[model samples]
Target: MMGDTGRRRRSGPRQAAWEFFGAELKNRREEADLTQAELGMRVFVSGGYIGQFEQAIRKPQLDVAQRLDHILQTDGFFERMWRKLIKDSPYADYFAAAAELEALATQICEFAPTVVPGLLQTAPYARAVTIATNPLAADEYVEEKVAARLERAHILKDATRPVYWAILHEGVLRLPVGGRATMAEQLDHIAALMRTRTVLVQVLPNEEGAHAALGGMMTLMEFEDAPPTAYAEALLSGNLLDDPALVKRVQATYDLIRAAALSPEASLALVESAAEDYRRCASTT
Candidate 1:
């Protein structure tokens, strides 16, 4: 019972697992009296790669894991842990950086042109969107994804949470998903969240033609420790940019877009009106 309580006192499962792996790696390397660069040389991996793994920021592949285990004299410890971590996160590479950034973000500003950002999406809406993306996503998979997305939303309610400013294109509200009932519910959810003061939602009307961010959806996250980063994603691939120059360019573009969008007060009114229209439509059918 005492040990169980001690384990419970440790951080959450994901954080705990990462810390455990990191501690083991650090301890083994130190006991071997090897610097990170020295270990990298022996393993034929980059020093940066070694540092990332030790910090648990990146998971290693099988070959890399085996090499680390052999070099650290841990005898397959790295391999087992790597496998477990991968099993726990299927889309790790795709979303891991974003998740880590979200967890520590002090401010998050987003511009979504076509669809509602994932953090603001309702469960039914998220599920419908995910299902439509992949015909092979079974009902259970869709449910799991929806659950994950909703769990991510908890960051907004966190006590010491970040300031979230989201600029959504009017098209998102106009496109009905899961039928009128679901759309109404989703709009109502957004309005309710806005009222809570945790979220600031601005709508970029279609009339604001040819905006600066005609590229795609972008989220700029500012952190307490590292430099700010900008995330841009399409259907197949995503990029995380930390270069100060590039980030400044994106930030300037986002500022312009924000300026062109409706004010928060007006945006909320528009969203509420849309919800009402959807409610009336639902009632008629």
Candidate 2:
């Protein structure tokens, strides 16, 4: 019965379940005499974003769901739904635990030797990565994943201040994804964020070969009141390491990687020039 009957309506998620969830959110907020804007203010998302949550156009991460539950006094309804939602996502199985921590992280340090880190990915770049990684997935399913991947960055933009420090290998700049235009745009976006102090990016030059972090990507996240954890991911498998020893080793490796990387200023210059080169090539093509 809730299927699209008009141009404005968009179909997404498990229809009946999301409807139940969204309805309860609206009802509870109304019961508390709070507008969507007011609820969003408390929830640390935008008013329009709250509307999207109602329509299930976006899915909330576990921590965001908890925040919403606390703000709306929904008795863990959103958190319950978030659990189910995570079980149904198309991403690597082990990444969900890490994603939850990322939402609450006060600081994030990442070393990406192969590709752009997920949080800094643009829409086109993310879609390209997903399609390449999931070659057999249905179009609709892939779109769902792409949308979710983009949503992960919302935490960094929200009221909770998280310092993001990224160490990217020089190869990440040369290896083009989604073609030259998209890669160029992606680099420009990173530069813009750096200029605004939204993120700190350093590039590890190619000549720094045979380093401690030779392969794979890792992210170290820190919370205000919790011990830090590290996440490392391969093509289809990932691990969340919480043991203080393993995480400490990873953290030390990352520190060395940062030391080997170009300074932030030099990294920004390289990124800008590489982007310009890509843009030029794309224009010619």
5-46 in candidate 1: lDDT tens per residue? 223322477767876887788789899999989997888766
Task: Return the TM-score for each candidate structure.
Answer: 0.78, 0.70
Off by over 4 Å in 2: 1-85, 212-215
lDDT of each: 0.79, 0.79
Q: Write the per-residue lDDT of candidate 2 for residues 139-188, one digit (tens) a residue.
A: 99788888888888876685445799999899999999999999999999
**Which ten contiguous residues of candidate 1 have the minimum total lDDT?**
1-10
Q: Which stretches of candidate 1 lie over 4 Å from their true place?
A: 1-10, 24-87, 90-93
* Per-candidate count of clashing residue pairs (backbone under 3 Å): 0, 0
Q: Report lDDT (Cα) of residue 17, candidate 2.
A: 65
Q: What is the lDDT of candidate 2?
A: 0.79
Residue pairs that clash (backbone atoms under 3 angstroms), model 1:
none
Question: Candidate 1: lDDT over CA atoms?
Answer: 0.79
